[model samples]
Target: MARVLYLGGLGRSGTTLVERLLGELPSVCALGEVVHLWQRDILDDERCGCGARFSACTFWKRVGEQAFNGWGNVDVLRVHALRDLVERTRHIPRLAAGHMPMDEVREYAGFYAKVYNAAAEVSGADVVVDSSKHSALAHVLRWASDVDLRVVHVVRDARGVAYSWTKTVTRPETDGAEEMTRYSPGRSALLWNAHNAAFGLLGRRGVAVRRVRYEEFLTDPRAALIRLADFAGLTLVPDDLNFLRPDHADLGVGHSAAGNPMRFTVGRLPLRRDDAWVAKLPPRQRRMVSAMCGPMLRAYGYPVFTEEA
Candidate 1:
């Protein structure tokens, strides 16, 4: 059985960083957001973390051959269409309610099973880190008997996430091509609450879940990794904290289809909280975001107060 550590949460919640850190372990194979594989990496030929085009990566090429007989055999458009229907957040509640048609669920699970199984076979790692950031997909995988699924639900402060989304998006993999992710403060807040709420619902339904707050992890990475390592069923190096020392994370070749451009980042990684939004975001926008996120913010231990007193 493939042990899949699925990262579930909204974007800009530090899932990429957490996935990269765990991917450094010998027993773990980090595949960035396989959800985007069909369109971003395979169809668009995006750069993999190994600095090669997706189709040019030897490991992924092997996975393609192993998973679907060959990369050419996979129909990108068809798979994407099915995925958009099955993995959309709007479909999550129904999927959980067992209202999703069995055929759709089967199709979704069968395709992903091949992907995850192929990844484990090609990488020779029992555990695969998939930072897909989709609560709906995570719920779908819970029913896949072929996979032993564990979830790491990452939550960041809504204000921090809202600010991150507003910043210019850049992908190191694409050089200067602008990443098109931008959301207004109000939209970001509403999505953050909904995303977090979905994951919470999953946990209540008795999924094997571990909640990791971005702020808490940054403050004490060693402790966070220890808990995560246990949940994902991996042993850590005695001095795992050394991974974060010198303000950089050592990275390896990862063939993630969709993720932050930082996936192309190698060598030492600086660790710091981006709280610039507190000082730079307009007071009115901050107040609006706080109001939108209101009770949910407090539920996650974020203060409802976004403006400086």
Candidate 2:
């Protein structure tokens, strides 16, 4: 069967890095944020910051090779179909809860093997990475019977994520601006909280999940990649990542999400904990994020200095 990995975590938390690095395996193909179900109405919504449309990207092309009956487009239909197949194979009790069993995991693995073989038949890839960082999706993948699944949890400091918004209205990489969450100014903190809350449950279970701190991954990329590759059961050679040009194309460059992935350059570097919030946030906003998420920060080993003091 085809091997699959779940590279998911809090949004804006660095799951992309995991996807890119894992792509090092000849059998591995990583497709970030399959949010088609959430945005079911807009299949041609836009290309990700990676500079490829969800409809015709090289990444999805590889995944399509593994899908049931050569799924033509990576749309709501494909996602729904995949979700249903997983549910049936695994005997998922709650669609919302997303719980599964060992038997289901095996079934899912077998189904994915079919996908991988199909992908190999078409695109010659052996593994697939799905960056649908939602905890519900992650839960299903971890326990489903049809596949062998690995879940990578990525987390960034809440402060760093909050400050990121202040740096620019547009995302650093993806310039597309229509979806910016302006309803709540403090939405980043809420996003950080909700995203983590979902995965925090898995951490408590003490199996099928591993957390990757964004700062740590950035600080020692090669070592981090090696560790990650090892966790996913792949042999890592120095040459595997050289061909990865993070800035190969700019998605969401001109509009609002410009500073996203397109803004991120893939390179060998050390982990960093940026304090952009220190200078960017107003006192009230900073206080609110601190007051609201102080516990989560400490739980992840991040210091909540203001709260302690």
Q: Pick the candidate with the highest TM-score.
A: 1
Worst 10 residues of 1 by lDDT: 240-249
lDDT measured at residue 48 in model 2 versus the true structure, 0 to 100:
43
RMSD of each: 1.7, 6.5
How do the predictions measure up, each by TM-score? 0.95, 0.69
Residues 1-309, model 1: lDDT tens digits? 789999989999999989988887767888899888887777788888888888899888999999999878988877877777777789888878878876777687777778899999998997999999988888888778798888999999888888888998777667668565899888998899888999998887778989899999888776788889889887777765466664556665566766887777777677776678888788888888888888988888889985563
Error of 1 at 152 (Å): 0.6
| Candidate 1 colliding pairs, count | 4
* Candidate topping lDDT: 1
Candidate 1 regions with alpha-carbon error over 4 angstroms:
239-241, 307-309
> What is candidate 2's lDDT per residue for 76-193, written digit by digit as tens?
5544555565544124234324444445444544443454455445545555666667666665555544455667888888766776655534433234454443323377788788
For model 1, what is the C-alpha lDDT against the true structure? Answer: 0.83
